[model samples]
Target: MSLKRRLELLEKKANYLDSGVKIPQDFKKFNELIGLPISKIPPFKELPIFGYEMDIISNIETHRDYALNKARGIGATEIILRWILFRAVQNKIPGRKFLIVTGIRLGLARDHIKRMINLCYNIPGIIKQSSQYNITINNSEVIAIPANPAAIRGYENVEVIFADEAAHWDLLDDDPVLEAIEPHRTKSNAHVIVVSTPNGRRGFFAKIFHNSESKYYKDVKPWIISEGLLIDRVEVEKVQKEDYYRFEQEYNCQFLTVRYAAFPPEVLAILQSNSMEYQLSD
Candidate 1:
């Protein structure tokens, strides 16, 4: 039988058996049901869930809006994609939407959608249709697009939105991408998930992570030398010696002073202090 015919039969079977099928509420259970692929190598292996990953998932389950300031090479992205796929498949509401907004490029966003599709391959009747930018599963849809304000404003009924590499989003116009998402997310009451490594001491990601008043449940995980979860301690120490700034910003999760700035933060602070004293002397 053709792939189209096979899908038709699966849909028919799903419609008949849907009432009895139990969707797991816990993400771990759902993940076990459709095992997570560990590698891109053939005869793919199942990913063992890590303690930190489970902590991130627990935060996701508890909080509607979450921000993660993560170090490089952690499995934050993989965990999030699996959770999104789980949500897309289990959603019963018709025409509900999920979105992934990637930094600057539509192609990167589409790649995320593709990963979601790959996750669906083992399961039957979940994926109805898939393209580069969109996937239709049952009555719900998951879409991927660039972090462009005009493009973002066009989506509605969005149940969840993932802002990937959020710190690197173009801030030429003071982050209109986030500005655009705010109204849409507010109107839809959608869960907003922002994940990125530290870019600098700027952008929406940095602001939310630092702001205690922000609603996002923030989680920050750097390279734990004792645990050595994702990155090795020797490699981290090597980088720390080679490029201290890079180590601080990327691995230590510190929002360092922007490299291209005219003066260091201390110099600027001194200048401001001198000007204040000069005004008082006048």
Candidate 2:
């Protein structure tokens, strides 16, 4: 603890006693004021964050849309949930809705978010409740949904949206989902962050990272990433020699061509020649 944090918490005590209700004005200090690093929260035992990781989190505070490409087991969900909590507690609007989309069930998403909910206990007048994968923190409502067009397409008035494990999304190429997700974003300039490990060489996740300069995209580089997951360097070295592609993209955080074509060259050549053409002669 630093002198600055001591002063901040002292001020919080005065403010809390006056009204018995306080909404933190500066979310940048929320984590510090809470007096608990993410590690001590629960489930997570430790977090070794780099300086770049701190900078990226600051950048995300103001960006309208952002994406993070991280290696496996690199704790992308923890960073994202922290950002969402900042947005939720800082915003004044009720019905300030949020969405968390995941590759499958909401287990992991639920876990990270539950940690955020625990921190709310320290903040006075903050109302929170949880049922399954849905949580209400202060005035914001967060609902975790599967990553599919049907789940994403119909939502409206969303203030922020997060796509977790985006590379594994089933409706990756579905235009309708994009159509819906894209519209509200433009209306409110909603914040969107997509976090994932590299999977295939194609689809929405791939497109966002590869085309970062596109008008609506803000590509966020992974700050906490290493050259590779050197769990046991000798063993990892042997494994990488046998499966280099997975090692690079899955553990090393490089989004290369780890995936292969669904159709082989022989089949693709046949389709190319036929052109799937249809002609009618009367």
> TM-score winner among the candidates?
1
Model 2 spans > 4 angstroms off: 1-18, 38-50, 170-175, 216-243, 258-282
TM-score of each: 0.84, 0.72
lDDT of 1 by residue, 1-282 (tens): 357746864664464347754556777766655555474434554456787888888898788788998888777888899988888878888989888988777778777888888777656667888899999988789988877888888887988888998887765653687788777557888888888989887888888977889988999878772245456788888999999889998888899888878899999889988886666543
Please name the candidate that would achieve the greatest lDDT relative to the true structure: 1
lDDT of each: 0.79, 0.65
- CA error at residue 89 for candidate 2, angstroms: 1.1
How big is the positional error of residue 159 in model 1, measured in Å on the Cα after superposition? Answer: 0.5
